[model samples]
Target chain A: MEAKLKYYLQIADNALILSHRLSEYCSKGPFLEEDLANTNVALDLIGLAESMYIEVARQENEGRTGDDIVYRRKETDFLNVILVEMPNDDFAHIMVRQFFTDVFHQQFFSELRNSKDEFLMGIAHKSIKEVLYHLKRSSEWMFRLGKGTVEAQEKAQVAINKYWKYTHEFFLENDTDSEMLKAGIGVDLSLIKKNWLAKVEEIFTMSNLTIPTNDFTIEGGKQGYHSENLGYILTEMQFLPSKYPDAIW
Target chain B: MNITALSKEELLVEFEAKINAEQKIEPLDWMPDEYRNHLIRQISQHAHSEIIGMQPEGNWITRAPSLRSKKILLAKIQDEAGHGLYLYSAAETLGVTREQYIQWLHEGKAKYSSVFNSPALNWADMGAIGWLVDGAAITNQVSLQKTSYGPYARAMVRICKEESFHQRQGYEIMWKMMEGTKDQQEMAQDALNRWWWPSLMMFGPHDSDSPRTGNAMRWKIKRETNDYLREKFINKTIPQAELIGLKIPDNNLVLLEDGTYKSGDINWDDFWKNVNGNGPCNEQRLAHHIKAHTEGAWVRESAFVSGFQK
Candidate 1:
């Protein structure tokens, strides 16, 4: 695979997997309004993934449709960060995962809007607005939960501690990043990491939460190394298309 | 003279006059205890139905055959949640808290629409639900827009608009399926067969047997009878099903000269069974609802503690 194609898939898969995770909260949200809000965020992420997947299909030029890329790929072929594919164990966990990703996406998409590739730039420009809203909502929840009762505060802390290691995967760079950056088709991850940490620290302080000092980071979802969760997600997501191959839904 | 000083008989006379004159009964206006209780029951039940209705369609969101379908399903389910919120707010105006209503639901003391007790077993079930279930709901809600309660009527007006979109998207799914391979067509037909009678039952019992119908109609809370709305749904939906070439699952269904289709008898025993919590998915639906509620207790408590509630 070409570096450019691999780069697009990496970003696209992150949105796709995370969107799938968020969509699971559709009917199961704690309240009606929260359900609607979560689904809206999920829809926005899916829209982003659709656009990126369209570009991926175009670049692949293998007669593969966007649906083919999303539904037909094996778990190992997905390039999303493992953070996105984790189960939504609780509302706090969901919000914490979202906050981490939303902060990264806010910076990443804003910078990607400056990419040399016009399509990537267009997607990034359009998506950054939605990501900003997501960031605000997640940050508000973070503060709400952190400053809430002892139970809520503890839950939020637990979620942050559990998910903290996954944040490292967001900044891990590979040859695809180097190639895309050299070609002006991607933004630098180091800058995104710096901005991400500062934002996390600032929000954590306001929420009365502490940032983890742990240095151990789990990686490899970008290289198709994933947790056990992704396989179950794909099995459910791809069931219909796989069962009735060649039939239009 | 203080409004509260009015005698019960005098207050009843004024309330009846206002209702008879087709005036909307606002939240702060004087209403009889029975009227208030009736509106609370009806509106809260509607709200709970919308919430419970999410699960069957939600079952297919992940397995939606395409991105477009997945997004549409997600949006539709989200709309159901929005409808739940609207109806819950409307119910809250009757002096019942949302927590109270939800508690009743979790306790199985409150009733939602029984149609959701049936499972959506296939991807095509999405189409059937959107077309048949929502089509039936719109028929009932269109009449509900004229209900005497002001807030409930306004909520119906907004809900009806979104429901029409849901109905169309559902029909679009069926249409696309019918145009696909032979197996796809079969799937659509099978789904319609399973959903048709249940959708008909959504209008509640027949006029003669419905206990709430008389009082509801006298109060103008229900402008049409169950039989009337069921007829209207049948008349509107049969053609849409025909256009998609899916069978109605009613062997005895016929288009009467009065332009309404007369179908075979509904399985009222099954209907009552489902309503009384004996249906295929009654346990599953309520269990899922209670689980979500119980698991979210701490979250709700936190929201309250943080002054997130008004």
Candidate 2:
């Protein structure tokens, strides 16, 4: 695969997978308003992913469509980081996961808004507003979960510890990243990493939460590798289309 | 004299006069206790139906065959949740809090539309629900737009506007399927068959059999009878289905002298069974809601804690 295509898939897959996970909370939210809010975010992310997939399909110039890329791809073919594929075991974990990605998306999309590729730059430009709102919501939840009560604080810390390992994958530099950066079509993850870390630290400090330093990390999803959880998610998401591939939905 | 200072008979006279004049009864307006209680029951039940309605459709959100379908379904579910809240707010004007309304649902002290107790076993059921179920609901709600209660009538107007799109999307799904492979067409037909009777049952019961609606009708809380709305829905929906080349699943359905299609007899036994909570998914729906609420208790509690308030 070319550098631009791989880069597009990476960002698109991240939004798609994360949005899929979030949609699982549609009716199961902590409250009615929160449920509606989460689904709205999910809808935004899906829209983001769709735009990227449309670009991918256009570049490939194949007969396959954006929906085809989503429905026909195998679990291992997905390029999202494992952080997004992690289960929402509880409200704390859901918020922690969202907070981490929202922080990354905030800086990443802001810098990507300057990409040499006009299409990608437009996507980033339109998407930055959504990412900022997502960041605000997740950050507010982090404070509530981390500073609310002893039990709430404990749960939030546990989620932070569990998901902290996957954060490094966001900054993983590969050949595609290097090439895309050289062409000015991609933002520097290392630069985004610096800003992401600062934001995380600021939120964590205000929330009175501990930041873990043990650097065990998970990777490889960007290269079409993922956790077992991705398999289950894809199974359900792809079931109907896989069952009746010839039918138009 | 103050409104509340008036004698009970005077208040009833005033309330009845407002009904006669088609005046909206606001939250602070003096109403009879019977009217308030009835409105609470009806509106809260409507709210609960919207909330429980999320489950069957949410079932299809993950597997919604296409990106457009998935987005539509998710947005529709979100809208349903919003509708639920709107209704809850409207019912609260009658002195019932949302939490209390929810408790009634959880404890079986209240009831929602029993149509949801039927399982959505196929992808085509999504289309069926959007088409048939929403089609039936919109017919009733369009009439509800004229209800005497101010908040509920306004909520109905808002809901009816958004609801038509839901029915159209559902019909589009069915039409697309009917235009697809043999298997796809069969799937659509099967969904229609399963959902046909239940959709009819959504009107509660025939006007002749529903003795309890007298008070509701007299107050204009319900502007149309159950039978009239069901017939209106049938009359409107038949041509749409015929245009799509889909069957109505009613063998005895016939075009009458008035040009309205009259469907076959509904299974009242089954209707009563579902209403009494013996339907296929009754326990599951209530259990799922209770579980979500119970599990989310700590999260709700966190918002009230001193640290969170700080």
Candidate 3:
């Protein structure tokens, strides 16, 4: 049960953190239509987080609500990957971050639909459809910006170089992952990584972009270590709930 | 359809007759330059207001008290962006490009609602903005659905539907907070205190001082006077405030025997000051907008160069 809870938290925290990052673009998109698109994507991610958190709460059976699990957790308790917590420095960086995750989720959720856990299967089934649309949108932007103009191409390359190292953390297996895999209630990370790399390579080729050749990688988010940005995100996200701990918002 | 053959006097008589009969004015229809200019200014300002309005409410999206509240706030702000697009499209029919309108906004040549110049300091301000600010906008927009221009009226029809949802969500936030702890109730009241008069100012200056009201009313462009709509909003809103156990923030607020609610005079000096670009957040709002626009320049250039113009 603890392993399953950790697995669920790992996925939920990723969605929640990334949704928080994207929500920052709510009223600040490059244009009106793009703003709406970014919000739609953010809403989808947050919705997924809500569902996963609900499942985690039910599984824990400690009378904890989804909000309790999400809003009351300390920074060291979160299990999101370091990639999702990275700052959205520009449109290029935002789209690259999303593009990397969407590709991974496309493979991860598709395999997750076959999980032995019924609840996990149900979430994966619903999430797969949303992630496919997300994949299409992010990939289209990646192609446009990568192949468009000299400046856009340069910006896209810079973002890819900065974010590529974080992609390695997606495949880093831990005890919770191994336990879920043994129980047939989680995806095989190695397989998902292989498929993710293949799809990313294909898209990069089409976009006239190249993958980073550096072997260095950043890790630790799944084990609760995170960048400084995650602390700021938590401070803001948990401010109201922390201040009035017992009040219903 | 070539009204070029008709003299200006003859065209003016026909145009006046169409407007008198409450006929819809299409983009291709023959109209005076003044009418086109009036609609452009009004419609573009409306669009810019939608864009700028996103900022105040957006200040709370990251810190909303709950997951549900966060989602609601995000969707509402997205709707504002949609409203901005719709109004910009409506303005484009008047032969001005969206680029020109955006440029004008960045240059401070175009004006949006001054109500947005105020900061949203507390979570309750979200409720107040949605309730009072959006409430006032709906009163004006409901009248705009009957505006003389066809495209503008259609856009308002779509906008008012979404805005009604925004107003309800805002009110729901206020209601929830009022029913919560004492601190929550105080926050709700404080939000009202800050947002109240600025909301009244959203109706623009009094009719006696408004120069364009005469031409706008004549052309059926403005369906109601600023003072008239402001009065209607107060009468409708005062009851809701009382029901929620919140004060109206005006000492002079009173109910007359005629069923109208009267309030004290608005701070015209402040209103004019904000309108003239001296408001508290005027520079901040414009600066943020310009920064976003400038940063996104590369993305826009890429999209255009990639043949994704549409």
Candidate 4:
């Protein structure tokens, strides 16, 4: 039971953090259409997190609300991988990070749809539709950036190099993941990784970009370890709610 | 179409007759130069306001208290962006390119609403801006739905419908805060106090003093005077504030037997100052947009190049 809850937290934490990152680009998109599209994805990711966290609150049965789970948790307890917390240094960096995650999620959610837990399966069923659209958008953006102009292609290359090292953490499983896999409650990250790489390679071929050869990887999200980024994200995200603990927004 | 072959005086007479008869004027209609320029200026400025207005509300999107709040604010800003697009498209019908309109905004030759020039200072400023700022803008826009120009009026109809929800969402925030702790109540009241005067400033100057109103009203481009709309906003909004237990922040305010709230004099000095490019956030708002525009140039260029290659 405890491993199942952590399984949900792992996914929720990633979506919630990434949603915040995308929301930062609300009015700052490269164009009006892109601005709307970026924020639309931000809204969808928050909805994804909302569903998962609501289930987390329900199963915990501690009289805790979804808001409490999101707002009251300390920095060290969040389980999102380091990649989603990466800064949106520019549009190139933003799209590369999104493409990496979307490719992974496209496989992860499709696998989760086969989970023994029906409610979790329902979430995956719903989320896979959104993930499909997300994958299409990010892949199109990757192709555009990789083939667009000389300078744009250079920026895209820099961004991919910066974020490629963190993608390995997506498949890093810990005790909770293993336990959930044994119970048939969560996804098999190894299978997700193979599919992620194939789709990525296919897109890169059309994008005229190269996959990074260096495979230096680090992993700590399962232990609630994070980079310096999550703290700043939590501080800004939790400001108003944290100020007045009794307040309801 | 045949109106173009008529003499200038005859065309003017026909245009006035159409406006007087409440008939729609199509894009091909032979309107005067002054009329065409007025619609271009008004529509583009409105579009610029929608674009720049995103800044004040957008700051709170990341900091929104919950998933629901975050989604609502995000969707609202996206609608503002959509509104900007619609207005720009409508203005383009008058033969101006969207690029030229954006250039005018960047060069400071175009002016948006003065209300956005002030900073959104607090969390409750979100509520205040939606309730007060959007509320006031809606009051003016509701009348604009019946404006004489076809495209501008139709655009107003769509924008006003979306705008109604924003004001209510804002009022909902204020009501929830008013029901919260003392600090929250203080925040809500503070937002109201700061935003109230600026919202009144949104309605523009009184009819007698407005130079633009002369031609704008005579042509039905402006359906109502500025003072009339300001009074309507004050009358409708004060009761909402009082209902939510917020003070109106106007010492000289009065309530008439006719159930209207007569506001004190607007701070026209500040209004004029902001109009003349000297507000607290006028430079910041425009610069934020210019920076985004500048940064986005490469993305646009790349899309154009790759688009042609395809």
**DockQ of every predicted complex:** 0.68, 0.74, 0.71, 0.79
| TM-score, chain B, each candidate | 0.96, 0.97, 0.97, 0.98
Q: TM-score for the first chain of model 2?
A: 0.98
lDDT of 4 by residue, B163-203 (tens): 99999999999999999999899999999888989899898
lDDT of 2 by residue, B169-227 (tens): 89999999899988999999999999989999999888889976999999999999999
Query: Cα deviation of B305 in candidate 3 (Å)?
Result: 1.6
| Model 1 interface DockQ | 0.68
Query: Comparing to the true complex, what docking class would candidate 1 get?
Result: medium
Give the number of the best model, judged by lDDT. Answer: 3
DockQ of 4: 0.79
> Residues B240-287, candidate 1, lDDT per residue (tens digit)?
888878888888888889887899999899999999999999999999
Off by more than 4 A, model 3: B1-4, B308-310
Query: Which pairs of residues have clashing backbones in candidate 1?
Result: none
lDDT of each: 0.91, 0.91, 0.92, 0.90
Question: Higher-lDDT candidate among 3 and 4?
Answer: 3
lDDT of 1 by residue, A179-235 (tens): 999999999999999999999999999888889888889988999999999999999
Q: Which parts of model 2 are misplaced by more than 4 Å?
A: B1-4, B306-308
Residue ranges of candidate 1 with Cα displaced over 4 Å = B1-4, B308-310
Ten-residue stretch with the least lDDT total in model 1 chain A: A25-34
Chain B TM-score (model 1 vs. true structure): 0.96
Candidate 2 global CA lDDT score: 0.91
